[model samples]
Every structure is written in C-alpha cells, then in structure tokens.
Target: MTQPSEGPAATGVPTCYRHPDRETWIRCQRCDKPICPDCMRDAAVGFQCPDCVREASKGSRQNRALYGGERSADPRLTSYVLIGINALVWLAIAATGGTKSRLADLLALRANGLCSPGDGYLYDIERRVCESTGSTFLPAVDDGAWWQLVTSVFTHVEIWHVAMNMFALFIFGPALEGIIGRARFLAVYLVSGLASSVLVLFLSSQYGSTVGASGALFGLLGALLVAARKARLNSQWLMQNLAIGVVITVVGWRMISWQGHLGGFLGGVVAAALIAYAPKEHRPLVQWGGLALVTLVLLGLTALRVSTLA
Candidate 1:
C-alpha cells in the first residue's frame, strides 16, 4: 500500500502547473512553479513561466520613438509647437482684422516697400499696393527688407489657405520630426520655405505679393519622400497623394504659386539628402553645416536677384 505524501513526492518528477499531464524537472525561477517545455521561456538567469514573463514585461522598460524612426522621449513636441505658432499667428490676424488692418500690413509680406502707409506712390506699405507700371518699382528683396522672405513663410492670405496648410502640417509634421529629429526637421522646413520664397521672387511675376506656408508644407512632402526612401518605408501612398496635389496645383497655377511649391520641394529634397547622407558619428555637425551651406546658396541667389533690382 502506498501512502500519498502531504508535500510533493521526492521520487516522481513534478508535472507542469499549466499542463498536469506533462512531467518536467524545470521550475520557474521567480515563482518556483513547475513549468513544461511549452510553458517555459528562457530568461537571463533561468526559465520563467508565461505569466511571470508577462508580468516582468510590464515592469521592464521599453523605449521607442513615436514614429518608429529614432529613440525620443517626446516625438510630437516639435510638430505641436509649429502648429501652435501658426495657429497663434492666425488668431492674431483674426483679432486685428483682415488685410485692411495695420497689423496685417506690418505682418503680411509685401513685394514692395517695408515702411508704413504711403511709403511710395508706386508702393504703399499700409495699403500693400504695388504698381508695376513705373520703372521705379523695386522688389521687396531689394528694399533691404530681407526679413519678408522669412516672415512670408508663416503668413497666410485666406482662412481656407491657412487651414489647409496647417492641416497638412499637423498630419505630416510629427512623423517627419520623429524620423529626422526636431533640429533637422526644422532646418528642412525653414530652408525649404526660404527657397520657395526665393524662387517666387526670382521666377514669378513681381506684380503681386505672395504669402502662405504652402511652400514649407511642400518642403515637408519632399523631405518625407526622401526620408521614407532612406528608411525603406512604403511611400506609394505618399507618392500617389503628392501626384494628386501636383495635379491640383497645376490646375490652379494661375491662382497659386506653383513656383513656390516647386522651389520648396526641391529645397526639401536637398536638405533631406544632406540629413540622410551625413556621417552617423558627425551627423549633427554635418546636418547643420549642410543647412548653413544651403542657406548661403539661397542668400547668394537672393543677393544676385537684389543686385538686378538695384
């Protein structure tokens, strides 16, 4: 006659807690419960049960970037900041009034003079009136108001315009920022914006003034294309959407600044190239230097354009 021991028997092997039918000599290091091969998971020191592994996973730390590009604590910060700036500017514009307001005149980008109302009969700053009828008319770039090139990137004409551009930025900004990081993303944006404005100044007709973040938005699109390619991501959808945008722009080329879009796209491609190709060890320095070189080239082009006006 055999007597059942109160504790586990010392003769027979222990069965898995999960699987009573299977016998195993293994035990969970943390819980000391018998675990079979099916229930076993190798740990740093010893085997752990599925439940214990799951619990440990909860306690363990895992760091991942927002868009799966880099390890960042805050991935959406830059995108939200940009959106906030644009929204605040739009709100300020709404509070002051539309084109008629003096604030709008000051903030808006004019292709003429930089002064207040009635600066010139041909060009009025307050009114934003530019008369291309006379030879005395000079582009705003030649007026020593180079700040317009930068300011104009943030300005928008209509509500729909700002809304559309901001919506695009909202969708694309975070992902791009996560992949390229805040600094490089910002450089791509600003450099592309400046390039678009410069193109408008040089290539487009100077009869009217241009304003909007479309240039920068276009830059983001171009940069995304390049960055996605570098990361081996699927960009077919992006390419399709971009093709549609191009079609729309071409359809409304008369009303929209296609030149700005073209320039921004090109600039973004160049900036993304620099950022993507830089040496990993000196990425920050190389990226910054590349941005600076791009800026210098743009500035030189602007100088050449201004010289023509002079």
Candidate 2:
C-alpha cells in the first residue's frame, strides 16, 4: 500500500524535541504524542497525541450531535413544525366543499364558466382528461405557476389524510433535516415534494384533485435512510421506521396514492444522496442537475396528462 505523501517538512517538528527544563506537553488525549493540531489525530472531543493511542478509550456521545453545541437530536421539533404547516392547509381545504366546481370557484380559476373553485389540489382523472372544466386551484399545465407544486403539498381532502401525512413528516423529516442543516433539509423537503408529484402525474391511473405533504414526508424518510448510511450510522432504528412506512403504505393504498408516495420517496432518496453526500465542489452541480431533472419530469408528466385528455 502506498504511504501518505508526507514531505521532509513534516518529519521535523516545531514541537520541542526534547523538553528538558523549559517545555512540557499537554499531549494528545488519544495518541499521546505532543502534537499540535496540525499533526493531531482526529478525535471527537480534543486532539489526540501519538503516544496515547494504545491507552485511549472513547465514548460515542461525540459523533451524533445535531444542533448547537452538542445538543440532542431534535427530530421531534421538526416533525411538529411540518405537521402544523400541513394541518393549516388541510383546514383550508375543509372550509370548502370537496367538489370539482366548488374548489375551482374558490381558488379563482374559471374557463367557459365551467371553472370550479375552492381548494382541491388536482382535478380527478375524469376531470383531468375527459372534461375541460376549469380549476381555480389546479394551475394550468403550461403556466408559470410553479407555486402549484409547493402549494399542492398543503392541499389534502380530509383530516386523517393530512394528519397521517403530517404524522409521518413529523417523525422522519426533523431527523433528516437535523442531519443536513436547515437549508439542505428544506431543499430535500421541497424538491422531493415536486419529484413525488411529477412521478404520480406521469404514471398514476387516477387523477382526481390530489394534494398532500405525504410526498415530502416520504422524501424525508428517504433522506434519513441515505444520510444514516453515509454517516456510518447503525440504521436498525431507521430501518424499522421505514418498515412501518411500507406497511402503512400498502394497507392504505385504496385511500392514499401509492404512486405519489413512491415517487416522493424515490425523489427524496435521490435528492438527499446527491446533495448530502456530494463533495463540496460538486454540490452546486448536483443541486442544479436535480432542479433540471425534476423540471423536465414535471413538463413530461404534463404532456402525458394533456395527451390522455385529448
């Protein structure tokens, strides 16, 4: 095996070679060598000098820190915030009657006096393709209303739907976000939501106005799985959580859209892996590439939806 490329400059030490009377060493707590940080072995708490290597015993509290100054993980707080946002949106939908024209009438989109308003995130399959009734809520396929993807996440038909979605989001999202920091976590959440929607719109057989944060919630789970792996974590706990998701998904298939869940899960996984694990230099490329891929997929799904209608 090739040795590290340490030049002669590293062989000599500014550290006192032989401290007779004037010099002493704090020594690295680990290796015990009198090394400055430049030569210090990696440790969780403080530098480890070379001589202490054989004697050092370590505890694990060092590696798993998530927030400020060695604070405990805060996935719980993250979950509650997500639940609150989704719950607010769910209440908005509930205020309106869960009907095609009613939602359209409320959201303010009308076509040929056929547009219904209120807050249904999607037009059902029959409405999406067989009819051209307008929607105040569902953005036009070609319009620049990118907010649709984001807002769509908040639109759920019933209390239990949003509640379940928010519950899962509360569990997984905070954990994942805590690992990646607020900004990265936000990216994972939003992009995964869009990815999930695009995937459903592309492959789903049913098309009734659909909306929920479940896609983002699934994305958080995916990100948590990937991040755990990268962090060299023992993922048994997270794996069990994922199993719960799988069970809930299969059992609830008639009520929740599996296509959206799957799409969102996959999107979250890809986005998290790409963002969380990429080298610093490559992060920008990964982010832009994700945006481009999701945008293209969204466009393609729209085309397919329109074609089916025609």
Candidate 3:
C-alpha cells in the first residue's frame, strides 16, 4: 500500500464519530463530524449528528404566550372538545325525554331532595311524607348526589338554552385559549363551574334544580376581560356585554340561576388574575398555587354548606 496520508479520508472512508466501526461519506452539517445514517438527524439545511442536534435544542428558547403559557398549536381545539362534550350530553338528554328526562333529574344540581307526586313536577317534601304519598323521590347533594355539581354544568333542558351557551362559548373560548393556553383555559372553566355549583348550593332554594353551561361560559367571559386588561386593549365592549348580562340575570332571576352566573364570574376573575399577574420568575408556581388556594376555599365553603344541608 502507498504511504498513509495525513488525512484519514486519504487512506480510507471516514468513520462515524459515534460509531467508529461504521464508515460514512456524509458529515454533520452543524459540527462537520462524520456521521452514519443511524446517527443522522434532519435539520434545516442538512443532516446533523445527535450531539449537535441536542446542543441546538438546548440553546433554543421555548415559545410562550404573554401570560407565561405555552403557545398553542391549535387554539380552537380545547373549545371544540368542550363543545362536543356538551353537544353529546345534550343529545343524550333529548333522546331520553327533554325536560322530563330522568337523565336530567340525575344530572341537575339540587341541594336537597324533591318529591314528584306523579304530576311531572317536583316539590320539596320530607322523604317520609313523599314515600307515604307513593310519590317518586329524588335525591340531592345533601343525599350524596355530589356528582350533580359537575354534571349539571353540562346539562340543559331546552334547545335555546344549549344553543345560547354554546354560541357564547364558541365566541369567547378560542380567544381566551390563545391567550392563556389550553390547559389554563380548561382549568378556568372547570374551577368556575365548580364555584358556580357551590354558590348554587348555598344561595338557591333547596327545592329548586339548576342546570346549564352558563356558569362556565360566564367564567370564560370573565377570563377574557382580564386578559384584555392585561394586554392593554380597550375593554369597553366587554364591559358593555357584561352589563347586558347583569341586566339579563337580574331581569330573569326567577327563571335563571343568577347564583351560578355570579359565582362563575367571580371564579373566573380570581383565576384569571392569578394567571395573568403571576411573577415572571415563578409564574407557574404562583398561578397554580393561587388557583389551588381558590379551589380549597371553595371546597371549604362547600363543606360548610354540606354541613348545614346534612
């Protein structure tokens, strides 16, 4: 053989740095190191070695929203999922019996039991008396119907009711999700719904039943308002809409569950404030911690209410 040249390529094919036994003609675009097919990772211009790829990833900053939330790839995804769930539930209720659906009875939030005296209407009555009258008895939160607190948020008896709430969700949900990210947006919705239920347990008549996504939608509205304020955008339109909602709630108090609306609004405000104003140095900690505290407070209030009802 001829005398060995100064360069390895002059004598033989270059070997991969990672796998010395494997020969390769390709060099890493980033580090210019010989790389075999197994060691190659595609990059903007050409293939890179694993080491170079890892180093580049480390140096790259992750994309985040203004409120310290991860930027969403599809902001409408979460809202669409929520809407789909509500729609499915609504269809189930309709297929069962609309207003008189047993599904509704099982899902609607009621603080105390009610008696249905074979008239398709419920009345507050003692279990003993209801049984004596041969009427059907329905249990409530006080009687271990705790699931109703969440189920009711997805329940609706009227087409118009579901339509209006879903329309509102479609309008506001994606916007807020884009700003705060999907996970935070979902948390705001659920916590707000729970808060609304708790307030309903305390404020509504024990005999009355409540249902609908109004609470969660109101929560989104509240969150959107806070986000707008934080972004220094004009919120006059939001304020006007809120005022209109307040008027509607006041006027329709006899028919609507104002307790749910107010509770959800308040919950959303607190949750959004915590998320939007969290310290940049410890954003996730402060945001999640504040939400947890709010949840605990709501639970404590629920426990207190349960004690009274029990």
Which tens-of-lDDT digit does each residue in 1-310 have in candidate 1? Answer: 2223245434577987876666679999999999978788999998999999988765344532222224445757877788787777777777777654445555544444533324333434332343433223333656777887887788765789888898889888877887876767788899999999889888876555777888888899999999889889999987986897799899999989998999999999999888887876887678788889999999999888877766
For each candidate, the alpha-carbon lDDT, in order, equals 0.76, 0.60, 0.87
Candidates ranked by TM-score, best first? 3, 1, 2
Give the higher-TM-score candidate: 2 or 3.
3
List candidate 1 segments past 4 Å from native: 1-70, 114-139
Index of the highest-TM-score prediction: 3
Please provide TM-scores, in order, for all candidate models, with all chains considered together: 0.70, 0.60, 0.81
Give the runs in model 2 whose Cα sits over 4 Å from its true position: 1-81, 98-147, 284-310
Ranking by lDDT: 3, 1, 2
lDDT of 3 by residue, 178-268 (tens): 8898889999999899989999999999888999999888888899899899989888888887888889999998999999999999899
lDDT of 3 at 242: 88
TM-score of 3: 0.81
lDDT of 3 at 302: 81
